[model samples]
Each structure stands twice: as C-alpha cells, then as structure tokens.
Target chain A: MFKGKFVDNLPKIYGLYTGGFLLFFLAMMVAEKNGVSAKMIGILFLTFTIAIYALIGVLSRTMNVSEYYVSGREVPTVFNGMATAADWMSGASFVAMAGGIYYGGYTYMAFLVGWTGGYVLVSTLLAPYLRKFGCYTVPDFIGTRYGGNFARFCAVLVLVLASFTYVTAQINATGTIASRALGIPFGTGVWVGLISILLCSMLGGMRAVTWTQVAQYIVLIIAYLLPIFWISWRGDFGLFPHFTLGHEVARIVELEAQYGLVKNSAEAIKAAGVPAGLAYINVPHAAAPEGAMAAWKFISLAICMMVGTASLPHILMRYFTTPNVTSARRSVAWSLFFIFLLYFSAPMLATLSKIQLMDPNLKTSIIGKPIDQVMAIEWVKNWISVKQAFIADFNKDGILQLNEWFMRGDVVVLATPEVAGLPYVVSGLVAAGGMAAAMSTADGLILAMANALSHDVYYKMVDPKADVRKRLLVARLLLIVIGVAAAYIAAMRLTSILGAVAWAFDFAMSGLFFPLVLGVWWKRATKEGAIAGMLAGLISGTWYLIYVGPAFMAKTPWLGIDHLRFGIIGATVSLVAMVVVSLATKEPDAATQKMVDDIRIPSGKTVISHR
Target chain B: MATSKHEAHWNDTKGLMRITLALWFFFSIVIFMFGYQLNSVKVPLLGYPLSYYMCAQGSLAAFVILIFWSSGKQQEIDMKHGVSDAERTED
Candidate 1:
C-alpha cells in the first residue's frame, strides 16, 4: 500500500511490462532477421521505449497537488530504489562511464567510487531526516528549516542552476545516442529527446516520473549488462566476469608493453570526438590528471561527487516518495545496491571491450591491422559517420597503431555490441536502454527544476492562495519551458556530456550540500547563516569554474583545484561563512529548534509547522 | 520535543552514524588517497590489483553493504528507543 492508501501489486505490473518489452524486442529482432534494415530497428527501439514511458505519464496524470508533487509518499522501498537508481544513473553513467574508464583507466574509477559512496551519506545524514521534515522539494526544506523565503529563494536558484546544467547534459547524451543509432542529426535528436522527456513528466509530475524511472532502470541495467555478458562469453572472459576482468586488465598491461602503448593515459589511446583539435571550443576536461597531481585530484573530485549525490535535488526528491522515514533510509540502501550493478560492471565492460580490441588473438582485433582495412569495418564506419570516432595515418604508415584510433568516450557503451559482433538486436536493446537512462534522468531533472519554480516559488511565495489545478498547471508549463531550454543548450554541444555533468555536481555540492546537512544536524544554525552560506557557495563555486575553466583561462588552478572540482572551494567557503555567521548570530527560535530536533527521531508524523 | 528519550535517541543515532561513516570513509576515500601505492598489492587467487579492485568495484560493494547494515541497525535502534514509526503507530 502506498502512503495515500492505494493498493496495487507493483512487482506483478512491472514484471509484465518488462516481459512485454523483451517480447517486443524479440519480435523486432525477428523482423530484422527477415528483411528489416538496421535503420528501421533503430527507429523502433527509440519510438517504442518513449511510447511506453509517455503512456505511463498519461495514465498516471494526477490533479492532486500532493500526489503530483511527491507521489503521495507511498512508494515502496524497492521501487523507490529502482527509480532513484534510474534517476541517478543519468546519461553520464549510461553512455560515458565505460568509455571514461576505457580511456582514463584508474583515474575515472573515482566516478564509480564517488557516485556510490555518496549514498552512504544519503542513508545516514540526510534521507530519513528529510523525509521526517516532509517537504515536497529540497527548496521546501531550506525555506522551512531556515524559517523564511530568502533562504528558500537561494535554494531555488541553485536548484535551477544545477538541474539545468545536468538536464542539458542528459539531453545532450540522448541526442548523441539518437544520432548514432538512427542517423538523425544531433540537433534534431535533442528536440526529440526534449519532447519525449516532457511527454512523461509534464502530465503526472513526480508520480509519472517515479513509475517511469523504475521501468527505465530495468531497461538500462538489462541493456548495460547484456553486451558485457555477450562479449564475455564470446571471449571466454571468465567463470565470473569480475575475476576475468582483473585477469584481462593484467593481460592488457602485458600487451601494452608488447605493443609500445603507454599505460594509464587518455593521450595513449587518443579518445575520439573529445575536442582536442577544436580551437574555438573550451578543452573538454576529459584528460585525467596523472603523475604528482593525480591522487589529490582524484580525492577532491570524489569528494565533490559524494557531496553532490546527497545534495542533488532530483535524487533527494526520490526519498520523499517513500512511505516513512524508515522506508526512506532503507530505500537509499536499495538505491545503492541497484546502482552498484552498473558501477561494478562498467569497469568490467571497459576491460572486456578493451581486451576485445587489444588482443590480436581475438577475432575482433582492429589495432595492428592495416589502416584502410580497419576503416572499412562496419561498426567503425558507422561510428565515424555518426562523429563518434576518428582515425588518421599520422606517420603515413599503413598499419593502425594504438594511438591512431580516436573515439568519444561517451559512445563506447553504445558501440560495444556492434564492435563485438553481437546481434543487431543487442545494439537495438542497448540504444533503448541508453534512452531510458537519459530520459529518466531528464524527466527527474526537469521535474525537479519545475517543482523548484512552481512549488517553491509560485505556490510558496508569489501565489500562496493558488489552488491545486493552477499550481499543477504552472508546474506543467515550467516543465515544457525548461525542457526546451535544456534541449537548446544541449544542441550547442558546449562540452562533453561527462564534463557538463561534473559542472552540475559541483554546483549542487557547493551551494546546497552544507546548508542541507547543517540544517539537519545543527539546531543552532540561524536563518541568516543558511542564506549567507548558500550565496557564498553559489558565487564562489561559479566564480572559480568560470575563472579557472576554459571560459576565461585567465587564472591557473588554486591549490590543485581545477574548474572541474570548483565545489571544493565553494563548499569550503560556504562552511566557513555558515559556521562563523551562525555563531555570530542568535540561534533559531525555540519552536524551530525543537522541530529540528524532532526530525532526527524519524518516528511520529512529519514536522509540517513551517506551513 | 527535547524529552530525555528524544535526546537519547538522537545521541544513539549520532553514535551509529559516526561508526558507519568511519567505515564508509575508510573504504571509499582513505583507500583511494593511497590509491597508487595500494596498486602494488594484488589478490593472489583472483589476480585483482587491490587498488583497482577497491576503486572500481570493492568500494562500491562495500557501500551497498554499509548502507543496508546502517539502515537495518538504525531501524533496530529506533525500535529500541520507542521512536520508530511502527512503535508510534502501535501506540
């Protein structure tokens, strides 16, 4: 039973949905085997997945404000975990993770550790307390906790800034997958992504987004695991994939010595479509800092990601859907478990796929072959035409050396099935899964941003008297508007998908992380302190990103803190400002302080006194 | 709101978090700080380089376990303190 007392057999429902999706996929594969073109299969994958999610959105459309905003807080722990995993995975995890590791090696391992480690903080420091506080949105928590609109208003701004950056990256990823799979233009692809994302979230809001995300997570995890399993079996990767993954890495290290390839460097592999040659564009921060700075940069980046996970509006919003504080705490564990399936396998996929390309003993070996022959391979040509990979005979040698192959780290997962000679159905399945990953993230993000605007701003501040329908209408309209804006930014292709995502995390980590954490733990934290901290963090982090980043290139990194890890600086400034300011000022009133103390208990009813 | 039982519950929860977070930080962060150094050690039977396994796989798995342990334990503590939602509803 949901919090609203609705009764339904969720596992049975989703089980059938997954079964139907797989059957439809098999039927499409059979169609492909008969006479259908690859292009037709691609189109079917994109359309069918989007159609299902859109149908879910339409079916779940709600007029009730509470249900629309937080799914009436009745979501079961397991389902919420699935939805949160889907929401958290985003385009960055789905498309770029395996590729990021493929090129960057151990350095990109930070993303996995950082991303999952953040959930520990979520379970312990935030989720249960936030659920007890019972806010519809993150900004709602800030506004209520600090006892004013100004603190809430600052949160709203940060939410917009962080979520917009993240949503744009998700849309950007969808565009890339769309173009590569269907041969559609990237520009056209983003708009399609926007329309599909809006179709789901614009109607039912969080209720639709939550259910849709659970379905998406299922597709994405299956899509992600299938190719890894397929290629592992083909290559005899191992009795268990994890053990063989380590062996494969050792083999790769052994081969690197044999083939004169440099170890632990993207420069060694020459990752394609990463904008090394684009003079006008800012250098996408895909290069892993190695040598003396590597360890420090890794720790700092992981810290940002860990903090960002606990702070990101869309992710934290999922916990609010749980039935109780205990469920909220329990769901974060489930969320971590679900996300781990992909994180553990991403390294395995990176290893297996690289081994496939690296080992001359394997049939799929492309390197060490003549350049002309390698270019003629079908997947290579398709990836090139889609602007995902690049190659050149730099030394005028006919042989394709390891350094000659260049590829966007974003497409490795998408391209792996075809590269390993899996069936066309696997490729179709991967594309749909990639879409589910991207669209689920986008829907959650767009809903978060719209809720910040419509719920936190319009309903709470500007028009407190607005009725349910009016408030929801405003939310729906904001979703479409924000979706289109993110699509437009994504179409520009300003930075790599992972790079933009890092920026979004830095924004969340900088501005919201401390305020939210401190709010729950420290009853003495005053209203003025939260506002000061939020502003200080927002300004400092953004300032550092622009100043040291490719935008201006005016200053060198301060204390090894680059544009990619601006959150460290912002968060440090925020912590100081908040702590100093709070001690300088009088503590919050007794009633508010009492409410804060009660939120820690995680029993009884939600603390709704702020209303 | 600041009753003795409520205060004690908060104190107990804090103790649990301190322990949980210490293990979390050790696995997910402390190991990574000495990342390259840890790469020197490899598991014998499995052949996983320790640092690589920890960074890419082990830490993530540890996090999942840590979360479930903390939450399950926290729920027990909540019940013991008579502040769990189940206890409240039963009342």
Candidate 2:
C-alpha cells in the first residue's frame, strides 16, 4: 500500500511542506530583522499559511463522487494518520489547550487523558469495524446496522447537531487566529477563515481536504514546536524540551515561592471581561478537595471527553479514507503518535510560559512605584496595546501585586514567543500554526455535516435515485450553507474554545456514543432501541444544559453533578434506554445480525445493500 | 465442525477484549480519578513530580503502547483462526 503510486508522490508533498516553511521562515526573519512592522509579520504569516492549504485543495481538485466522499478509500496509512492528526488537533488543542492547563491546573489534565485515550478506543473499538463496513458516513452505519430509515434519520440528526457545535468551535478558533495574525476585526476575521475553509473543502470534499490536512499538520506541528524549542534552549535546557521540562517545572515552583505566590499554582491573575464574582470561581489554585463529589466530576468529565472523541463524526470519517481495516487501526496509532508530538509538548509549554511570567526581572514596579513606570517593558506594552493581557494596580497601591497581573488563557500559547523575548517572526509562526490547526479541523467538520445532509438526507431520503453528479452538487451546496452558518455562530462566539469543545463532546458522548458502540459490538441492538436511546440521551442532556444548567451551577447541583458533566447523566439514560428497549422488543433481524458478525471479523468489505 | 471452531475463536476474542478493555479503563479513567494520591507521592525520575510526569506524558505513552499491542494481538488471533481480512478477500 505504501510503495506504488502513492509512495511516488510522497517526496513532492514532504518537500513542499518543509521547503515552503523554510522559505517563509527566512522571509519573516529577514523582514523582521529589517524594519518591517509586527503587524506586517502577522499578515505575511496568515497569507502564506492560508495560501499553502488553499493550494493543496486546488491541486487535489476532483468532481468524482467517491473521491469527494472518502478520498476514494485509497489513502495510505501514514498519510491518513497525518491527516487525521491534523483533523483531530483543532484550534482548541493548538491554541487554547496549554493556556487551559495553565489556568485550570493539574485537575484539568483530564482533557489530555480523555482526548489521547479516546484514540485508543477508536483504533480498538470503532475504526477497524467501520472501515470493514465500507460505509459512507456514520448515518450509513446506523441506517444499515438496524435496517431502517428511521434509524438513519436519527443518526443524521445527532450527526448534524454534534458536528455543527464542533464546527462552530473550529470557526471560532479560525476567527481568533485571523484576528491575532492578520490584525483584523474578529467578525471580519471569521469571514476570512470561512473563505479559506470553503476553498479547501467545498470543491474537493474529502479527497482535497485530506491532502490539505496533511500539509496543515506539518505547518501546525512546526509552528507549535519551534517556539517551545526556542524557549527551552534560551532557558539553557538545550534542545530537548521533553527531557528537561521537569527541571523547569521544579524551578518555576521555586520561583513562585521567591515571588511570594502560592507554590505550584498558576492562579488567574487578570480577569478580562469576566464579572468579579464569576472571576473568583475561575481560580485554579484551590486546595485539592478529596470528596466523592470532586472525584465523580473528574471521572465524569474524563469519560465524556474519551467517549466523545471516539464518537465524533469528523474524526470517524477520517478512518473511512484508509485502504483497509488494518490500515484504519494502524492509522489511528499513527494519529496518536503525531498528536502526541503536540499534546505532550503543551504542558511543558504551559510551565515555560508560567516561568517567564513569574520572572522578577520582568516584574512591574515594586511597592510605591508608579504604574506608568511598570508599563515601560516592551512585551508589557505590546500585550497591553492589544488588550489581550494586562497588569493593573487594582489596589491603587501605586505598585503591582502578585494578584494584580491578569491575562487571558488563550493568549498564553500565542504570546509565549513574545513573552520569552524570542524573535517576532516566531510569534508570527505561532499565529500561522494556530491558523493551520483551526482550518484543518474546520475543513473536516464542514465535510462531515455536509455528508450527513447531502448523503443521508438528500440522496437517501429526498432522491433515492439521484446520480453521482447531482449528489456531489448537493454536497457542495450544503457545505457552503453549513460553512456560513457555522461562521455566523462563531462570530457570535458565545463561549471560550475549550468550553464550546466540552459542550460538543458532551453532546456527542451522551447522544451518539451508545448507538455507535452498540452498532458494531452488539447484535441484539434493535433499530427502535437505537432511536429511543439517542433521543432520550440528546433531549435530556440538552434540556439540562439549556434550562437547569445556570440554576444548577448557581444553586444546588442537579443530583450533585455540574452541567459540564451532564453528559454522564445523558449517557446513563441512553444506556438504560437502549438495554430496556432492546430487551422489551425483538432483536435485530438475521441480516443485521450477519452484518454485525461480518464487521467483527474485519475481513472482506461489507457491501452496502441498499434497501 | 467449522462452526464450533469459529465459536471457540469468537470466545477467545471476547476474552482478549475484556482484558484489554480493563487495562484501558484503568489508565484512562481510574488513574485520573484517583490521581490525587499518586500526585502527592512525588517520584523524582525526570526532575518533575511523579504526578506531573504521569499526567503529562506517561498516560499518553501507555495509550500508544496499548493500541499497538491490541492491534498486533488481534492480527495474530485473526490469522490463527484463519479469519484474517486477506483470507476473506482472497479470490
């Protein structure tokens, strides 16, 4: 699979990714070393990054339905793994993740564990079987597994709802990247991201999207690694950040003591746009409470993340592009390897940023010093001008206090290069990297929603006899519609990237997890059981979040669990509903049983016997 | 006779799945849920606290090894039972 036609094209793509990065890296360096403005560096980086991904989309252009749908199922394991990694690491993972850890502290490692562990679930439980089924989308699996249109429709409903929330996160990330990188208004920046996303996904679908994602993975990983590498070397740890980050963590703790701050706590110092009351609740450094309630919440949030990762529509669709069931499994391992390169580095980045932040040399004026005197630092001036970070003398003591310094979590990774006094081009590179992360995931998500609409709704439901061209046309149109709608939602930007992602995961884990896991593993799961389980889960999970969440968070917790962890409740309801319904009703018919058995074996492809 | 052999293979597969899934649950959920205790006992191998090492890198490494291990083991089982994808797809 790796040696023939595909292998021949590998060098050219690899060369393009590496060579183009070097070329741009040099250009940005020389421009910055000269008298070019910082804003120009940002604009240059954004333009080059978007152009490279857009070019990949153009180069892989195709009108064939199969190619548009699943890259014609010919993608090699390595490339598919790379593409999947790119798709998996969204803007949230790239930009906000480190800052999340910085702000949320040790307990927040749940996001890391949940996400990486979920890939294991994919390779072991879901990906190989789905590939064997040779289905077009998640709904196709459900529709066929249960032998009913109602089942298919329900799957489509969950797919659209979950993928749309997930896509809006990606678009929201894109807006952040554009606003930071191109120096544009966030609302207009979302449109820029939308246009770039449309270019990569609208015409070429999965085929174009996959190759573009591979390019994007390369850019994002490099963008992510270089600044961290620079920070480690500057800190005198040499180039091995992973091996030496532990020492840095110890030093940072020591520094915290020196600065009269709480040891081992990255407390939120600045509250931007958050009310004072709500701000206090967002503190990360409270003493660890070992109550059962805390333990349950921790376990529930982790489960929601893991289950949600395995069941996400766009991530699952990446497996459908692999050549065979084995490749699907292997591709998932490869995805983990690539993702680990970034995920493993994020905590270290957080520690390093924290160290830079705690440096007394960079500290504002001491007691009785004027606030204006503290504002003279270059990085302080830059960040304050942008309003992304602040160090106010809240006590009017004429001096900066430890708690007086406040910065947004999302800006930590982006601002690390600058805060560490690295070259301005490196900051630009981080912005570009953040853009790649956002766009690659957005491309995959838009395709997933469009597939559910065009394949499941339009082709299967509206026009069962539609031709390939017509189906492709419908997909393209739906991609445009969903893209714009998602962008508009992103422009609204209701929540933080991590918050939005958690909600998306909650929806996916609660509503889709049982149906997906059961469809492959259990033959007794009837269509009726599947439908009832999904709706019960969806309605209960969403209803709690919309109606009871605020009151629940503000007052007494519902059943002693917060709204962020409501997916646990939803999953429980879903599991009970599925089991009871399956027991009360007839099992799946013989054909469906055979389908389940065949998927388990992972041998010859299961033909999609259309009803 | 073939049906009985296939059933035995299926049983073996199920047993293997249970063992692997147990390990999965421990690393992914159980360890994190009870991480407070482990986090307090800081084993100094890599200069960071033991808890930080486990949280940041160790769990992820275990996940990678587990996936690779499971995939390899499943392939062996499939081949031994003569139900490998190659066998099914062969003309």
Local accuracy of candidate 1 as per-residue lDDT tens digits, A166-274: 8888999889778767788889988888888888887888998999999899999989987888788876887568766666777877776676652224553354333
Pairs clashing within candidate 1: A3-A74, A271-A407, A272-A406, A272-A407, A272-A408
The 10-residue segment of model 1 chain A with minimum total lDDT is A278-287
Per-residue lDDT over A386-416 for candidate 2, one digit per residue giving the tens place of the 0 to 100 score: 7666665556676765555666677778778
TM-score of each prediction? 0.94, 0.93
Per TM-score, the best of the predicted structures is 1
Chain B TM-scores of the candidates:
0.89, 0.80
True contacts kept of each: 0.69, 0.48
Candidate 2 chain A, which ten residues in sequence have the lowest lDDT sum?
A274-283
